[model samples]
Target: MRLSLLDRSRTRAGRPDAAALEATVARAEHAERVGYDRFWVAEHHAVPGIASGTPAVLLAAIGARTSRIRIGSGGVMLPLHQPLVVAEQFLVLDALHPGRVDLGLGRSVGFTPPVRRALRRDVEAAESFEDDLDELRGYLDGTGPVTARPATGRVVPTHLLATGRGIEVAARHGLPVVVGGPVLDSDELPDLLRRYRRDFRPHRDSTPWVTISLDVTVADDDATARDLALPEAWALAVSRQTGEFPPLEPKEAIRGAERPAQVRRRVDASLDRAVAGGPATVRRRLDALADRTGADELMASTSTYDREALLASDRSLRDLVA
Candidate 1:
């Protein structure tokens, strides 16, 4: 399977956002050296742990630092921005990077009520995602209601960060999809993936390409790997309980922190869904998931408190997968 990187640009508990962003660029360069297919950055708003609020800006930096690996937004939330501006930003990336840019879009709202209000986006805003996608597609296809300048003339491959209705929308539009989260690790996801493939209708000269993405960290042993994976799992867990995604803390800190019973359950659930182990263990789990879903690529989203250890896990996973 093709391998790629999906960076959240995560901030450690004490580190500044700039450090996390620099880590992203450094990690992307490392990923390219280690034979990763593409490097996709995320977009998150008001999440202290995730510093990637503007994917286009982050991607431009990543693109400037890496010459070989494809770089793009793991997604730009389509409902959050105007179609024309989104198209133009990506087209600018295309102009700068030539044939090595990917445009992945998602339909998601800000993480909190205040954040949503700040964006002037409500939960209902998601309903217009389809319309926004059509406009973005039109711009890329050179049939937009208004010109998007260089974007109208240049071609950029697009993918959808999807699940549920999002998958159907992507299938209808014939865009490739990246699916992950706990759903991918479960038995039910294969059915959804199969249905997407069966229903997919190519929008142009294209075929469906599915990239399975989830948290992964491989170390010399199972315990160590799980340790490296703890930061991300803890972040997800707290996000569920407190309704805010926080930064990564050391594994020891997380293990000792006091959480309410319900929060503990959520934390355990978050930990359970991720794949973390030694090389052989990770490979086996990844192989099963890919085989079951027929994934074309593996987009790994791994982060931890120690940057060096995280990079080590990445290198180990890279060699093992390769």
Candidate 2:
């Protein structure tokens, strides 16, 4: 399986959010130097913890800084914007960088009701995702009713950042699917993926491909690796309790802080799901995951407050997979 990185440009406590964007570009440069196959960013609107909201703009910045690494949106939420505009934005990115762009789409409307209103989207907006995806593809392939400009004849590969139903959508469209989170632990996952491959209908030579994404952190020892995973897990736990995701705090700070029993349990559960350990430990877990899911690629969507440790983790994960 190939290796890739997905950076959400997570904000850190006590720092300007804009700094996270710069850090994302630097990390992409490092990912390229270390031979990562692809570098993807995410779209998260009006989220305090995440700095990136517009993936295409951030991807443009990343593409200008790195030469060879494949730069893409780990996804742009299809329900939040017009399909033609999304197509044109990525088309422009492809024109500047040429073959290195990818467009990963998702159906998430927003993080909260207010966010949804701000984007002029409601829960119902997601219902049109399939139709929008078809329309967007038409523009990318030069088959839409109105052609999207900066039309470079090149097709920017589209991937679905999918869940259960989204996987079926991808299968119907013959596109690659990226799955993670609770779905990875589901008993029905293997069957779902098998069905996806079996049911896939080819679209212009497209084939069914699956990329498993998760938080994979590596350090010199098991304890140290888990420590690196703590910030992200804590942030997740807090979000579940408080309904707001905050900037990542230092691991030591997270460890020393007080927490309610429920939050503690959630944190422990999140840690249990993450693949974090020394080289041999992570390798064994990844092998099991690959065997279970028949994953074609591993997109390590890891994050932490300490930038240097995160970089070391990225390099270590690349070596583990390569």
Candidate 1 runs further than 4 Å off: 151-153
Residue by residue across 1-322, what tens digits does model 2's lDDT show? 9999999999999999999999999999999999999999999999999999999999999999999999999899999999999999999999999999999999998989999989888999999899999999999999999999888989999999987888999999999999987899999999999999999998999988999999999999999999999999999999998899999999889878999999999999999999999999999999999999999999999999999999999999988888
Task: List lDDT for all candidates, in order.
Answer: 0.86, 0.95
The TM-score values for the models, in the order shown, are 0.96, 0.99
Cα-lDDT of candidate 2 = 0.95
Residue pairs with colliding backbones in model 2 are: none
Top lDDT hit: 2
- Cα deviation at 50, candidate 1, in Å, is 1.1
- True lDDT of residue 317, candidate 1: 84
lDDT of 1 by residue, 1-322 (tens): 8888899999998888899999999999899898888889999998888888999999999899989899988889988898999999998889899999999999888777899999998988889888889889888878888877675356789999985667778888899998865466556777888888899998878898898888888899988887787778778878887778899999889889987788777767766678899888888998887778888999988888999998888889889888
